[model samples]
Target: MTTPTSSTVLVPRIRGALAHSDRIVLPQSVLEQLLSEAGRESLPSPLTFRVFNPATNAYTHCGVREFSAPESTVLISPQIASTLGVSEKQLQASSTQDGSTPPVLLVSKCDLPKGTFVSLCPLDTNYLTMDDNWKALLESALQASYTTLTEGQTFSIVNPATREAITLLVNNLQPEKAVCIVETDLTVDITAMSEDHAWKSVAHRDAKRKVESGKVATISQDAPVRGTFSDLSQVFLFDLKSWDRSRPVIVELEVLDAGDSSERDIDGRAADVFVSIDEHPSKDYFLWSTQTDEKNVISIAPSNSFLATAEKITLAVRSCVVPLSFSLMVSQEEGIVEQKSAPAPQSESRQCPNCKQLFPPRTFQLHTAFCERNNLLCPHLGCGRIFRRQDGIPASHWHCDLDSFSCDSVSTKEKHILAHHTLATCVCGESFPSQQHLAHHRATICPQKLHICRFCHLRLPQESRDSQSDLLAGYTGHEFRCGTRTTDCPRCNRIVKLRDLDSHMQLHELQRVSAPLPRICANALCVRVIDDDPAAANSNSLGLCSSCFGPLYSPMHDPTGARLKGRIERRYFIQLTTGCKRSYCTNPACVTGRTNSNLPKLAPAEVAAMVKELTEGGKLEFCVDDGMTRRRRLVNWIGDDNEFARPWICRAVGEVRVGGEDDDPTSSEAKARSWLVENGVRITEVR
Candidate 1:
């Protein structure tokens, strides 16, 4: 066979995807040329190629990702470019005979050994601080981005959840310096780059914990902290570690001063400030977050799961402008009595009509002259604040023309208009007045919100409920339909709806736990449980099922039980004298079972004596039947101890139950022997 080979210019993949992978893209012309050179209809699957950078004198193996590059130009991933010491400088246009072109790498078809083991070392310890399940995430990232491995090469893996990137260097490889990772089971060992790196990682984690723990403010009952935020990003951490957590604490935030809004537009579009109480430093486990425009006295009871185990409560604030002042108080939920101040003594004064201010009667006229010229009353309805007329209302005091909201600052007015007047539409086609409303609508009530289906295990948009019944049933429309698909229950062998399967299986489990175990057939060789038939439950005396006790059953009555014992004796006599002579018989109590099992059979006189002795005890087992039911019992019993009995039982039950036409007495024994051979039921000698 001819080897396919080609030379092409390698350039770093600047724009498109697979930037972290080792796969490369080649020109379509190169692929066609390689195919023609090999004299084959198609190129081999997962085409492996060796790329050589002549300028750097370096080489690396790669897998083809696509054949859609520009003519004579190959697009190698950044990882591959780094591996071969190729840089973007080589991709710069050069003055050539055909205008401008730069190609500095050679590509050729080659075979590589499959990888068996690899050792990787992370460049830093940032990956150690990731979630505990990050190892699986790393493996997934590696699988998605790599097709080959080489020693001394470095690659980066990005976390999809947090978008954090960590670089790893290939430290060692087994079987070869480079190996094809396609369809190979590789043993991977991951370690920190060095011992010093591990120590630094630990130190970094401890330092972060110390900072967070030290920043938390402790609160006591009835005592509140007055806080001020200079900016929106300011966060206040508090802890109730010293207080009794058993009693619910009410965390209250009273806005003392909203600050000057006209200074600048608020950082957010909603409320001026948002307060939340969370357990985690990241606030991932928040108990409550401000959901409405309740800025006056926002009181939240920290009574959720976070309050039980949280060491610290993080009070995060997101706001529009700075210099915001608020009073944060934590008190017992039931004991908050408002304190009423004593009425202030009435002051003897005269009311000034111009600025609505009370002044001393002595200088009333003089005060009025200055107040009337310098101070001006607000012209807006319900707003009587007086400002200096010379400063032209200060430019900070403004009122909305459309609503009854009047506040200080032009930015606050703009924010109010945007929050209450501007309309926003969600992707689900619902419209809201503000972004905050839209966000809340999408998170809580949107039917198109993505949710994982419990039955189908697929992520899909939640479907609208068909009716109130569906809502009461706690199922989405998708779940209702998905649960309609039926599956056979292995325990009861009954078809049950997926939605009801849990309860049905639970019912079965309850029955199993509460009901008594079924009694085994009286026959020592039989493995069948005694059936609850009329003969087996009411009349049978040996605890045997109808099938096992049917032959000896009769309506004849004997006062002394002599006839019953005689029948049992006769059954044993027949087993010893004629012998069932079947190979599967393994009962140690029966003469036929012993004989077929390679044990010496008793003589006729000895058999008679043994039968008499057994019947004298008023109990005996019938084991001479060659019926299908009897054979099934034996098969089940053997299956418990022998792995090879399953196929034989399957074939034996199928043949006897489904196709029993050959039971013509003369051919019955021959058919049984033939079945033993076909089903591979070996007749082993008794030990």
Candidate 2:
């Protein structure tokens, strides 16, 4: 909403001297100056107007108005007059309207500058109604006008022809209703308004003075003065323009002391007084007071309707300040200090078994069980005995002696009890009452089936189905031999079993190689001759054969017949000394002739050959001491030696005869000689 600018008017400027003290006082000149300034200034001219009717107490709208020289007037149109229920003759007949029915004038103007007086002159009397609606309208209008006047910008009107100016100073206006016109000189700018604005400060100062002097200062001529109702917690309704002190307009609220009875004052004194007010009906407003103060005040708006309904404003009073004497007395009666508890009793001391150190009685008991299980004994080695816990049992109860033969004599019943009554049964359909009985029966009483090797008499399981039986059976016959490729048995004319072949060869008698023969004896003394089995006449024979005088010479022998001679010697020794009737060499290297002679010589060739012959013939025998019989025999021999022979040997072997004294020394020699003569007739030899 832009403010409209009024039409400009023309005026003259006159400069003249006045008769009083050289001051410019020309009436016509001053009038001309005013007119010129007014002409240059564009003022607000009303587009519509209102006139108040006193008799009816209502506002009627009049027609549009424009600014005129020496007067601000409204041009009342016939339509406007008819609409307002008034005649144009009445409006034209009056230069100024009656106070009861004044007209509202509007002018088109920019926002006024600070301190500029801008009046809404000829205001309608209908605006004075105390009705709520009228009051609200009046308030709104006042606020709006005030806002317009206080706008920061300044406005000026100038006449283009004469260059005369009018600077408007209209930025001062109260926000409330204007009951009277105020006139003041332009002083300060509107843009710099503060809380202490000039008009408000003056008002506050004037109000304060009025209050101190016991006079009721009204905020406005039409509103009532607000009075404090601290006498009690009550509400008050006030007219801001009048200074009327009337009865409260709202419901009375109960007042009560709010402070605690035992609370202390700032100086550490007991409190006996307090102040309080009841909860207000409107939660936005409340009453409050300090404990030290005995009065209460209710918070309410001057214009609130409920304030007028209060019957009385009563301030509940109680002593809030505490007495110092009362505080000291209470302290004396209650006793201010606290008491502490006494310490607990200490336990007695005792010795620890593990470390042999003293410890508290309770500690020893707690650790003794653990110490006993670990076998800690007294530190003194001479007495290194384990400490028994103090249970009421004899030392024998836990004896560890193992020398007693009692364990051997424990009965079968005891054994059964110890073995948890477990019984044993044999595969042969025999059963025993306990494990001990079963063990004894299996070891001694049971008829165990046995398989014996015919040659070695070694026991074997009856269930064995291997060729061991055949091997054993073959060994008992004269014609049997192991089928192994080499080392055949001479007497039986068969190969020995694989395992016995090497040992059997070591005992062969016939021309057997004593030490393995060299391939061709590097010593040039050994002879090589392979045996031909006469029993194998069906097979090819290339090597030499045995004869009475020498080897039956094979065509394959050495041309010089040296090997034949060696063969004859070997055969002779084997037959004559070994008493072997067989004719085959059983040595492995002799059969293959791959031996090295650097190794040590073995047993004599004749003995080896005889042994071999006996073994092959199934006639070899040995005497092995049976473990039970030999042990018994050894025990008897040892006992006899210890009883008789050892004593005799000890006496006879170490005894020494000492010679007699001088007189009998020659006699001793003569006796020795006599003894030699008696025993062997060697008396001359001794001489």
* Regions more than 4 Å wrong, model 2: 1-687
**Tens digits of lDDT, candidate 2, 140-173:** 2222122223222222222211223323333344
Clashes of each: 4, 47
* Residue 460, candidate 1: C-alpha displacement in angstroms: 16
The count of backbone overlaps in candidate 2 is 47
Name the top lDDT candidate.
1
Candidate 2 global TM-score: 0.13
Per-residue error (Å), model 1, residue 152: 2.4
**What is the per-residue lDDT of model 1 for residues 1-687, given as tens digits with 9 covering 90 to 100?**
224356657474544468788888888887777777668467666678888878788888788888897776787777787778755555454223454556578888877888999999888766765655566656656665787887888888775434467889999999998888877888888876788987887798777566432366776668987766675555666665555565555556665554333345332222332333322232121334443333433344445454564555555443345656666676665544344785554488778888777777889999999988798898776787887787777666667787676666555666666656778886657787766666455544456654556786654556677788777777888788778989998667899999888889878756534434345566654444453445576567777767778888779877787787777877788777776666656554566678667788787778777787777765555564455435555456445655334444334433544223344543443454455444333334111
Model 1, runs deviating above 4 Å? 1-4, 9-14, 26-48, 66-73, 92-98, 108-136, 159-166, 173-176, 179-232, 236-252, 255-292, 296-315, 319-527, 530-687
Best by TM-score: 1
Worst 10 residues of 1 by lDDT: 276-285
